[model samples]
Target: MTADISTPSRALDTDSTLPADAAAPASVTFADLGLPATILRAVTDLGFTIPSAIQEKAIPALVSGRDITGVAQTGTGKTAAFGLPMLAALDPSLRRVQALVLTPTRELAMQVAEAIETFAAHVDGLQVVAVYGGSPYQPQQRALRAGAQVVVGTPGRVMDHLERGSLVLDDIRYLVLDEADEMLRMGFAEDVEKIFGQAPTKRQVALFSATMPPQIRRVAAQHLNDPVEIAVTRQSSTVTSVRQTYAVVPFRHKTGALARILATSDADAAIVFTRTRGAAEEVGSALVERGVSAATISGDVAQKDREKIVERLRSGALDVLVATDVAARGLDVDRIGLVVNFDLPGEPEAYVHRIGRTGRAGRTGEAMSFVTPQERGRLRSIERTIRATLEEVEIPSPADVSAHKVRSLLTQVAARQEAGRLSMYQGLVREYVTEHGIDPIELAAALAALAVGDDGPRAREEQERFEAEREQARAARRTADVRGPRREGDRPERSRGVRRDAAGTRYRLSVGHTHGAQPGGIVGALTNEAGLNGSDVGKIDIFPSFSLVDILAPLDADAMDRISRARVAGKPLRIKLDEGAPVSRARTARPTGDRPRGAHGPAGRHDERRTERREWAPRDGAERKPRHRTA
Candidate 1:
């Protein structure tokens, strides 16, 4: 494949009248780019049917073995744009390094190496080595000595190898500088130049950058000869489908607050971003402590561990991931529904990139930021950069968290019921109740409360504190909203309630573990469908076969109708009561047929006498009901 390296279009305005290069005609496929059959087969296996814009334009130029300069965004699949052709152009028979790709950070280098390996999987006998700082270099040196055809490394370590004369690029035929602009920003321009000087002048050179700065272009002119230039434009300032939200969380409570938020969010998979590698580990550990399956990725993580973590995230083995900016580079997970910023991003560009992890490939996503009072200015800066306002969300209250958990439990129960495995549990329940002389309702309530961690004092205290803080935050936000810019018709709409019930109606749903239902999903579905805020929802009881949700009584008939028809986890909820009847009747019904045959015969006289005796029993009474026997 050859790039159309036409002469420059116009001369410089100055005396240096250098003609600008003409753009090349767009190619459509990897086949058009002349990729080897082996690489094409690998692409097909990877499920990439057609070439991306970068791939179509860059592959041809790269395969032609010409010096190329590409300007593209991070998520445009630039790694493969150069990687495929480089692998195809490799001389597998040769023992020495034939290609060298330098990245600004170790994470990017590892990513490039992994990508190259994936593309070259079918190309037998291809050895690709990734070398970076902060680890033993002997292993890398050994791999190089044994024969590595391609070397992907960070500039600092690559320079170290060059200085030590451990790496020989004299035989190198291709050189790639990925994220060229970032390398320059990191003060690696001098090192890049020095490294480029070491490679053969006649070698094929490729420089890929997200942005075209004067410095990057100068490097291109100095190193690349008659290079083919390709620029890929961003589709939009912000991904339209991503729901951007932020919370003003204090720095000290940010980690705890993030855990709570994640606990309450309807996220399948999430990425938590931190400014530093250490913070990634810290936040990841915190989440793990809170019983979330989590992993950390950063520039410092071993290549093997990073790959494993990425694999886990992709396979849904891990639900939450904490990563630094550089560590998350080249990650392309389709199931990542949420991206969180534990620390406010220092640059608006970084924020864009962080949030861009979600809302990928036309899929809807969410990006949430935790901003401290001091970082309010930073939040404004981010808003200005994205040219949009981020909706301020109140931190979820303890009640909200509890409700989410209950819904999750109920969803799990529904799933279990759908699986038709409730007979075993039913048997266990009957036997337990018979042996203990316990009321089934009381036993079920205890079990449900236990499952959702609804212990007495601690749970109440936590809920109270969370509610207080949430109310304070909401008040602050309402005040700010009143003062901030408002649309012409931004007045609050009057809400009408049809009735007010002293006690809410308890409606059941057909969702549980069998349906892969989570508490957050149920809450989200109800909140969205009912148009009632999370706060309006009450107690949630998750049984093995189903889940029960509390709705305000004097309920909006229209809302209830909508909820009954609504689909949760693709299943329409019966939305009635435990007895499979309307909520109104169930609320007033008394339990029948279930009375102990013992001391309380058919009549309720013995039970009433026992209750009276127990109530009259003094603290000093010698005979007392055993703690476990007082049903």
Candidate 2:
């Protein structure tokens, strides 16, 4: 199991200095890499004109069937660096798993699977399947049984299938350990080692990690053959063309701040990055409610729908796209003039990737991040990672939004006056002024106020509320500064005094008592998948063939999409808003003395008399619970 791979056969440091005459070619296309026409065509179709630093170096070695250890940060196109070459070398005609890629999280597993699927689109019979925890096993098992040529999954899930005899690595010719350091950090080292042992001894291996810790080095030396080592410099320099800045905004007001920021921004289009899919849905819906043209894309979005959404952004039909990191990976659009971090990313590397979405093709772009009072340390970390201090900027105020709108309106008015197309409008205005015996200038002013939507009392009230909140936030910071260094628990809770007592909307789920669906299971699914908090769930009534659940109102499309895809009792919960009248239980009614037909005696209440409690057994057959991180 061990090899003398401490010193690799070849070392390629992309950041190393080279003589002017010996430098890498200015541009190297996929075709120049000697890939098959099928892969080349697919890459070209995806609009990839040149390989990234990692891709330029690693693809050739990978294509040569050499094991590689790549040291690169996120957002360096590592997926393509490994995926393109892997696709080129895979045996499409084979009907078993020839390539096995292990990721640290389900989000990454799905992302890598989708990227590889895009690369293998033209390679006939090259089926790719992604298996991960927190999902049912039936579908993934069926995918494996149906002869998937490539398998991508989290280590624990993959190990589970291997133990169940559903996934055999006997034919695995290519083994990839992506984000190896993350895997080790997430406690997947043992599972990874078992998988490595089970795979074919004579196989090409690629181990990519942002940092080469001692543990990762040990794993690489023990498991990999004499491999080529590749290192890509951090992406701080990649985003030099991007003007990075941040705003200190409270979490509750982020949506309003984002709407105002977008309204005032001159960028043609923007992408807002959130830390989770649920945040994406919430932020996007809030933007739309604020009259901003916005859409959302997350892991829940279907591939075709995602493609259409991206196309809309490119075509300038959509101005704002709210997305999670994995969902927006490898997204390219020339018109993305701005990037907004709706929530600060957990890692600086992720911040780099999120901002890199813009400032492509030598074009200048702007990246703005929202920082809460507690997130100052994270902001500093990003600054250190980027090797630059981000400019602290103010969130656009309501006045700023009004001024921008007024400027736009005045510009239109001037254009119309210059074109001499406002004669009818002028006549109508004059007639109105004459009938009311009002000053013409005052009438014009009133019309302008109406045009900019600045005349209403509601608008004035909202503006005052916004200013008051901002002032309170400033006062809190000042008090914190004067008092100095309080314990975390000493900090006061931030609340808007909102109540959750209102009855939320009702939705029907396809799982019920007959399907062994319990109230606990339904609550878990809603909180875990749709990002609903326990308090957001209102009522649960389980019928024989279906269930009615009440969740907080204003469920956005993205949340609904996630809920629809969620599985309970090993079945898809085709959730939809309950539009029909309540289901009548008259036929199933029993005598007053008998037990009720539903899971409980009444709606919104669980059976308190039932004392039996069921616990989950570890599915991976390990002594500890399976570890996973999607958010």
Candidate 3:
């Protein structure tokens, strides 16, 4: 049978107390969705007062056995949307794996399974098990044998279970693919197909995603049977309590800049995000060298070891965890006072996910992204996606750090004085003065100086030197010109998808509108793979069949080589220096022998050379050529 597919077109549910969309029934209690009384009581005991926008719409539809395609952010209570209904529909008498949930990451799988367990906490004879990689297989197999009603797992691990005949989908009445787009990005499309092929043909399919691309739509059309569409269009994904800010630090000065920021901030616990596992370790090591209490985790870390690190972070035993996006998954810490994006996430959704880690549970938090001058364009794209302006802040100088530390010391002294704890110290100072013939005030000043430490002042000279070199780099960037008077390898700027800047040469990317490319995807690929900051990227002008971007800093031999071979939007970009002239309709019918009209030759664009990675992260305000979509 052909599947039924629908696109979500609806208003957002903004009110926390009530449903904001007209379609979703207002004042929806969990009971409104025909949830079993036992399940309702369980969720209520967990302090869930009302159904969220997604939950309000999804629960009722899913409970009625209708396939559903839901579009909502990660934190909008989606787990409950699918979990409660799956529980309600399950027949407790039949204890086989009635429902199977697939996730992209082990962390998400564990989270979903745990939530289902909580919902079924009071339901006797309803067993739930979470199976994922990096854990013992025997225990998972044992749980399956114990007759679990629900099984949640990542795609790869699930496939392994299916191959070994330890797990079967023949009884799967409800099948859910959470974060479906993420799964696709992580290369689970084939595994999903295999799993679906093995499942009961008549089972209900519910695919949930934050964004739906053509690939996801195709999957839905192939599987879902007349799915109901539920979309919650929130203006932004960032939690309202997070304050976003950025600093335009050059690549070379990032370490010093980070030090200054950390010295002045009042964060008790923080997570420093980096682009790669190697970078995570490097950043963590650097932070420790700078005297910050921190640790690092990545995919290379053992599972047991990773869990211990996360536990340490939760209990405040570790002040920070420098991590890649994957490693930070499944981590829930309330004491995270700040989040530092040492490198921007290539995936747009990841930006929201990172900041969402903080400012949770009604607590205020801060997030800062370190931007290079050239990466400003990518930064702007991120801002547009979030629909909020990130306040641009200057890097705190050495003097600034010193002054802040001094204030902190004085504040401590004031607190002690208020508590009457200074009397003992006062007597000690008196004794020192009496014995050494020194002024008591002078002795007190000496003690205060010792407590404050001298690192801030001592580092002043290095800071000044660094600032001078950084300015010189910027100066070179501003004065260098690669534009006119083309060299042999340089093509026309129009075809190259690059713009010449005073600081660096521009190369046009081979992929663009004609190849289904978007600026967000392009920027994400560059920053994620090349380790380039958003500020390092200059203006991005996307055209119907091409794009032009300027790089503010001249990439060295190694950097240029990496970018030339980089792939974006599933296409290897054959980038070359811009030198060819624009193609016009006038050449459409002209003979091959006809002389070229423009100054440049009629030759084509290039001859070769070219993350949690973002497939598409959109930027605001780009001139796009419209195309029609046939339903």
Candidate 4:
């Protein structure tokens, strides 16, 4: 059957509108933002090409010495928005706490402090300290005395510092409230107010929030003076490449349900969001028990320890992260392929922020929330607020888990075979067969039985039970289908089709014969980096300069992000969709004279030179050559 496979649209339609002036790019560069040359150099070294919308709008206003209120969504480069300008304005020579940034929780405080340190790396004699509860105050007090010009901390610790005279904000020139709404939600409003009162009146203040509730607006009105109000609307809030869904699982079975879901779903790395610190710990431990490499992040973790966990996650050493709302703020891991809500967030806004972690930049991501039976109403409320309906998925069965395990075992066996180490095992088996005078088939069957473990019968029984359950689910789905299609009046409608399928869209990748790419190489990379399997991947057509591959739609944003960051053949794959016209137009625009010849190019010219080179090259290297050269 000829499928109607086309490239999917990349635009995200949102109700949020951008300011008319924002359409024009800001003329300012890192140097123009009053940042010292050292800091600007540092930013360049970190691979940032241009300031994001929030940074462009908030930076200059902040540098002009005005109290500012910035309303921007998560992942809009808010850290650099405040960090770069603040660090540039700092007088490193003055050791007495010149700047104080208050975050809602310890995780955010640590994140802010890390960003400050990163931006201030080239600046000599700059001291940045992060203070929060759950740790000894003596070390923090010592750091303050030893001279920290920039202080990033939670409100409670800042208050404690003020009371103990360990941190003197009387000399503070710049005060920033990062994620002010979160602080208020965490009941740190009174502490924040007290901290504001402690600071000098001449200080410049900056309040950045995702959403400005009435209370946040009132606080901004009271604290900021004729503040330059910069609101970055939801135009940027539409993360285009992310495909979001939710699963309705009871609260008691949430942990088991999450495990089952992960077992069946294709995800490279996943982040499980919980409501509390304790929940993060409990869930993380449970995932580890189930053989998943998982870790937890919360307020209780030390700064050094949190950094270690985050680093491991980025490096793929950890596949799952369980974190609370406060613990996960400012986390930007490109490899996160999925975001799962083990427990529904208390607030609707928190739900948005939780899922926002996965789909970032221009990559596709998947967000799944686990809703309890009682919490279905709350889930509906969240759906109404976001103006999006979530699709429900069934929990995976034991058979699914067994299939995954068996596939993994086979893969390991294949790898061992390729490594040419099976000779030892072959000899051992041959000796056993000859000594026992047993039939080769019987011997092989005995070996296979041993490999599958002594409890193989029990495993088969479990698989049978799981298959029975799957049959039941299929019957139920058929019943639903027979009931008739959902009508518009059905309040919230269900999402049709499989979650694994990318909805029948094609994407283009910058890797092909030119990059030593094989079908297996592409499959491995997609599976390892995006958590997709070989079955989900469609047709792969390799061209000289690039390749086009059919991906199941809608693509997962987190998975795409991981693919973007992944390296194949020691080169970064700059992949995107062809969308037909763009590729055709570019190809048409190219002059025939400029086009390089493939393996089947004209003879007697450099074609022979290319052919000779290909003949001398290794098989892998030859595969990287153009088709004309290969011929």
Q: Which number leads on TM-score? A: 2
lDDT of each: 0.67, 0.72, 0.68, 0.64
Lowest lDDT block of 10, candidate 2: 1-10
For candidate 1, lDDT tens digit of each residue in 1-631?
1111111221100011110111132335455679889998766544344555677778888887777888875545677888888998888989999999987665556556766776786888999998875446699899889899999987767876787778999999989999887666544565687898888888888899978889988998898899998987532256667899998886667877887888898878999998766678888898898899999987556555776787788788998989876566546677788999997764555676677667655679999999865356567767876789999887776667778887888888777888896788899999999999999989977887787788979989988777777677668657655665322223211123322222245566776435544454455456534544333454444433456555542346666665665544556655654333222222245356444453334333323322211011101212111111121
| Candidate 4 stretches greater than 4 Å from native | 1-32, 181-190, 209-222, 235-386, 392-399, 408-631
Q: RMSD in angstroms, all models?
A: 28.3, 12.8, 11.7, 26.3
Which run of 10 residues does model 1 get worst, by summed lDDT?
A: 11-20
Badly placed stretches (over 4 Å) of model 3 are 1-26, 73-76, 91-96, 104-149, 153-157, 179-188, 209-218, 237-242, 247-263, 266-365, 369-381, 392-403, 411-446, 452-631
- lDDT digits (tens) for residues 581-605 of candidate 2: 3333443666655655564444412
Q: TM-scores of the models, in the given order?
A: 0.52, 0.63, 0.52, 0.50
Residues 468-506, candidate 4: write the lDDT tens digits.
755764674466447643222222111332222212355
Q: Which stretches of candidate 1 lie over 4 Å from their true place?
A: 1-27, 210-214, 237-239, 246-262, 267-365, 369-386, 392-400, 407-448, 454-631
lDDT score for residue 137 of model 2: 79
Reference-based TM-score, model 3: 0.52
**Per-residue CA lDDT of candidate 3, range 203-275, in tens?**
9988999899999999999999999998975434577788999987777778777777788888778888876
lDDT of 3 at 386: 79
